[model samples]
Each structure stands twice: as C-alpha cells, then as structure tokens.
Target: MRDKLLMAYRSIRERRTRSILTVLGIAVGIAAIVSLMSVGYGMEEAITGELTGYADFIGVFPAKITGTTYVELGSFTDRDLKDVQRIGGIKEFSAMTFDSAEVEYRNKRVPIFFISGDTKELESMYVEPVGLKEGRWLRENDYKGCVIGDRVANDYFDEVVHVNDKLIINGEKFIVVGVFEKASTLYASDIDPYIFLTLRATKEALQTDEINYIMVRVYDIEEAEEIAEEIKEAINDNHGLDDFANAMTMGSMIEMMGDVFNIIRGVLVGIAAIALVVASIGIMNTMLMSVMERTHEIGVMKAIGAKSSDVLSLFLLESSMVSLVGGVVGCVLGAVAAKVISLGAGTALGIEFGAVVKPEVLLGGMVVAMVVGVLAGFYPARKASRMSPVEAVRHE
Candidate 1:
C-alpha cells in the first residue's frame, strides 16, 4: 500500500495542472453544500429557541380563506373571546389590538407598531418573559401610560427616550412607564421595536374597539395543542363561520417551521449535489486519460510480474488520494464560506446568528468525496488492468 501510494503521488505530481483542476471541482461542490446547509441550521436553531420560549402559549387570530388565500378577515369580537375563554385547560388569556400609527416625541414623528391589551395580563403573558429593561409594567388603569421596546426607545427617534418621557400616540399624549429588553430572535414578536398601551387607551385614541388577536396560556403545557384546537372550534362556532378564526400553540408552530426548514435544506443540498456529480464526471475523464497516457508503463509493470489486481489498486489509490486532498481543502473553504455568509446575512437582516457546522458535516463531506473517487475510477482501472501486456507494449 505504501509503495502504491508513493507511485500514485508521483503520478499526480507529474500532471500537476490537471490534478489541481479536478480537485478544485470537488472542492467547489463541497463548499456550496456546507455553506448553504450551515446557514439553514443556524436559522433553524434561532427560530426554535424563540418558539420554545412560548411553548405553553397559544395565539388565536381571526382569519378566513378567500379563494385559496388565507387573510386576516376581521377583528375578534367580545363574544368570540368569551367562547374561547370558556374552553378547558386555559389558565389565562388576554385580548390584544394591533395598529400602525405615528408616534411623536421631541418634535419628531415616526411610524410604529402600536399594540394594546389589558396591561397586567399582557405583562404576565408576554412582557415578563422578555423582561423589562427599565421602569415598571403599566397598570390596568394607566390609560395614558405606555411601555416602549428597546429599539423604539433608543433607535427610533433622534433623541433617546427614557422612562417618564411623554409621547404622542395618534395625537393622544401618553407617558413611557417602562422599556423592554432587546429581543435576541428575529421573529414577528421581537418586541424590540414595539410600543405597548393599555386597551382603554388604544380604544380612546383610535376610537375603535378592534381586538386583533387573543393570547392564551395553558395550565398544562402537555395539553396545549388539544386546548388550542378546542379554542379554535369554540371561536368559529360562536361566530357562525367555519373559518372565522384559527388557534395555534407555540409547539405546533415550531413543528411547522421545522418541516419548512427541512424542505428548504433538502432543495439547497440537491442543487449543490449537481456540482458534485459534475466533479465526479471530471474525475472519470481524468482517470481515463491517465490510463491511456500510461499504457506503456502499465505494460512494463505487467511484463515484470505485476498482477492485474496490482494495476487496479494503483489506479484506484491515485484517484482516492486526489479526492481525499480535495475533501480536506473543501472543508476549510466551506467553513470560511459559512462564516462569511452568516455574517453578511445577519447584517442585512438585522439579526444575529452564527453558522452551525458540526463535526459530522465535515466527516460526511470527506466520506462522500472518497465514495465518488472510487466509483469514478472503477471503469478506467478495470480497462487498464485487463489490457493485453504484449499488445500494449508492441503498440506504443
């Protein structure tokens, strides 16, 4: 084996240009797979962590299907909320209204997400989990008070807002009671750029009682999914519409996200696999050319008592060595590429997540390259080994 490897090494070194190009072909394919898959894994991790944080919580939204498209049809009514609240296993629930409105502070106006709910219920159900950065949660009667997210307080306005700061929401004045800590995930409920108000205040400011959704917390998380289904049925029945509303638990959301990620990852990997297939073809062409060029050498070896098996092994080793080297280089390039992609995407999306390249991924890459090498070299090695030594020597 040692002698065979040294001979193969010398052969590759002799044709440095062709060997290097073939190796690069394999490397590029591996790098693409590694980088894309790593980013997918990282995103999956971030979203899964965020969803798990609300594992016992369920969100009920008023929605309907209109000609194959799901849309937010109408606001949840008080009757719908009453029916949902009567469902078994619900520990607590809160109705929230969402709106997009302009907030003015220090003579500057900014469009912001304006959310309103029962202050105390909202704090225990949503705010406390992410925690407050400063001040206190709004009281149920603090109709003129609000809590701001980290981004809204510091990043939105030219002036940094603080607790006790007065802001104008839809022309109505309200004081900042608290600021929430910055959220780490990149989901819709990030809370880092939101402003929360009491239900009464929002109704007064907007002149409407439009509850967008209801959030429910289950006493037993293990039964949350079942309770969510019951809540959905109850709400739909109360409204006399089959598709009036939908309820989903956090755990179910996570599972749906996982399924989506898996499909995306598979598609990306499949595209990358095309490159690997092309690389394998390149390997086969290179090995076949080597066999033709070294015909006389092969003949001489056979004349000197070398078995057909010996010739086969030598060619196989040469191909495997080239592929193994490519795999090593590919792994390095892949890791660097993954990091660059992660950083670039994080910057563009305004969210932080790292590339997740596991040891298993590197090992799998190497093994795949080896298998491709062996398969690509097989035919050429066989052709070279089965040659008639006398005919081969006499021809060239």
Candidate 2:
C-alpha cells in the first residue's frame, strides 16, 4: 500500500505542470463557493444580531398597493392609534411620522429622513438599546429639541456637529439634544443618519396629523406574534379596510430575512457549482491524458505482477491527491478573498461586518473536491486497469 501511494505521488510529481493546472481548476471552483457563501453567512449574522435587539418589538405600518402603478394607500390616523392601544398584551407603543427634508447645519444643507415620535416612548423603544453617545434623549416639553444619529452628527457635514448645535429643518430651528452611538450592524435604520423630533414639534412644523407608523413593545416576547396580529387587525378595522395595515414582529422579520438570504445563498452556490462542473471535466481530461502517457509504465508493472486493482488504485490516488491539494489552496484563497470583499463592501456601503467562514464550509470544500476527482477519474482509471499488458508494452 505504501509503495502504491509513493508511486502515485511520484507520477504526479513527474508531470508537475499538468498536475498543477488540474489542481488549479478544482481550486477555482472551491474558492468561488467559499467566498460567495461567506458573504451570505456574514449578512445573516448582521441581520440576526440587529433583529435580536428588537425581539420584543413590533412595527405597524400602512400597506402599499402593488400593481401597474405603485400607490401608498394611506397613513395611520389618530383613530387607528387609539384602536391599537386598546389591544391586550401591550406594554407600550409609540406613534411616529416619517418624511424627507433638507436639513441645514452651519449653512451646509443635506437631505435627511426626518422622524417624529413620542419622545419618551421612542427613547425606551429605540434609543435605549443602542444608547445615546452624547447629551440626553429628547424631553416631552423640549419641542424645539431633537436627537441626531451618529452619521448625521459626524459624517454629513464638513464641521462635526455637537450637542446644542442648531439645525434648520424646513425653515424651523431645532437644537440637537442628543446624538446616538454608531451602530455596528449592517441593517440601516433611523438610528444611523436620521434626525428624531418630538411628535408635537413635527405636527406643528409639518402641519399634519398623519401617523406614518406605530412601534409597539410587548410585555412578553412569546405573545409578540399574537399581539402583532391583533394590532394589525385593529388598525385594519379602524381604517375599514382588510389588510390595510401590516404589523411585523422582530421574529417574523428575522425569519423573512433568513428566507431571503437562503434564496440568495442557493443562487450563488448554484452559479459556483457550474465552475465545479467545468473543473470536473478538466479532471477527467487530465486523468485520461495521464493514463495514455503512462500506458507503457502500466504494462511493465502488470508484467511484473502488479494486479489490475493496483493500477486502478494508483490512478485514483493521483487524482485525489491533486484535488485535495487544490481544496486546501482554495480554502486559503477563498478566506482572504472573502475578507477583502467584506472590507471593500463595508467601506462602500458604510456598514461594519466580517466574512463568516464556518468549519463546515472548509470541510465541505475538501469533500466536494475529492468526490469530483474520484468520479471524474473513474473511467480513465478503469480503462488503464483493463488494458492488455503485451499490447500496452508493445505500443510506441
């Protein structure tokens, strides 16, 4: 057995260039699988982490009608808010209005998502989780005060904004009462670049009574789904339209995100599998060429009492060795590629996340390469084993 293994290694070494190229074919496929799948894993981790922070929370939003033309049906009314408040298992909720406005700070103007909500409720529901980086949360009576996100305070302007800095929103002046800490997750939300105002201030500034959405925090996470359904039903009932409002619990949101990531991973893996299929063909061709080149050597061995099974084992082992080596190289390249991609993407998108390469991914890559090699080499190995010794040795 040792001699057979040594002979196989020597044969591969004898054709170093061909072996290297064959190994590289398998490497490319495995690299693609590892790099692409690592991104999926990283994204899933980021999303799940963000969602977990809101596990006991539910968001109720007005549904949009999708068809030939997109239409926002309507916003939640004060009556809708009252109906939702009456639902059981509710700990507390906050009604929020959202709009886009140009904010001017030190004469530098930038477009921003303007949000107004019940200040105290907003603090408990959203701000407390990530916490405030500076100053304090908006007070109920501090109608002229607002809290800014990390990006808005630090990144959106030439001069860094500080607490007590004044911002002009649609010609209305508001003082920055607080700034939120920079969030680590990839999921973007009001915590990043948006400005938060008290509900009364927004209503007075915008001259609107419309509530864009309501965020509810349930007492028990176990009853969150049930309470979310009730909230949706109450809103729908108030609006006199079935399914007019959608209530999404954090758990449901996470599950939906998981399904989306799963589909994306499947599509990416399928594309990578195409490269493996091409690599398998390369392996088969390489094995066939190796068998033809070694025909006389195989015949000499058979004449010297080497069994057909020994010849078959030698060819198969050579192919497997090539694939296994490729898999190792591919895993290393893939991990580095994934890290580079993750950094580049994070810089481009302004989110922080790292590529997640699990042990299974590495093991699976090696196993896949070995399986492809064995299957591809089978025919060529069998043909070499079945050759007539005299005929093979007599050939040129």
Q: 1-396 in candidate 2: lDDT tens per residue?
A: 788789889989999999999999999999999988998898789779877987998988896534223345689887888888888888888888887788999989999987788888777666766778899988888778989998999999888998999999878999999988886556654478889888888878756667878899999999999999898788888778887888889998898888889999999999999999999999999999999988998899899998999889999998888889988988888888888998898778767888999889989988999999899989999999999999888866
Total clashes in model 2, counting residue pairs 3 or more apart in sequence or in different chains: 0
What is residue 157's positional error in candidate 2, in angstroms?
4.7
Local accuracy of candidate 1 as per-residue lDDT tens digits, 83-183: 88888888888999987888999999999997788777777656766788899998888879999988899999999999999999889888999988776
lDDT scores for all predictions? 0.86, 0.86
Off by over 4 Å in 1: 64-70, 105-110, 124-136, 150-165, 347-350, 386-391, 394-396
Error of 1 at 248 (Å): 0.8
User: Candidate 2 lDDT (Cα, whole model)?
Assistant: 0.86
Q: What RMSD value applies to candidate 1? A: 3.1
**Clashing pairs counted in every model:** 0, 0
Q: For residue 208, give model 2's deviation from the true position in Å.
A: 2.3
Worst 10 residues of 1 by lDDT: 64-73
Best by TM-score: 2
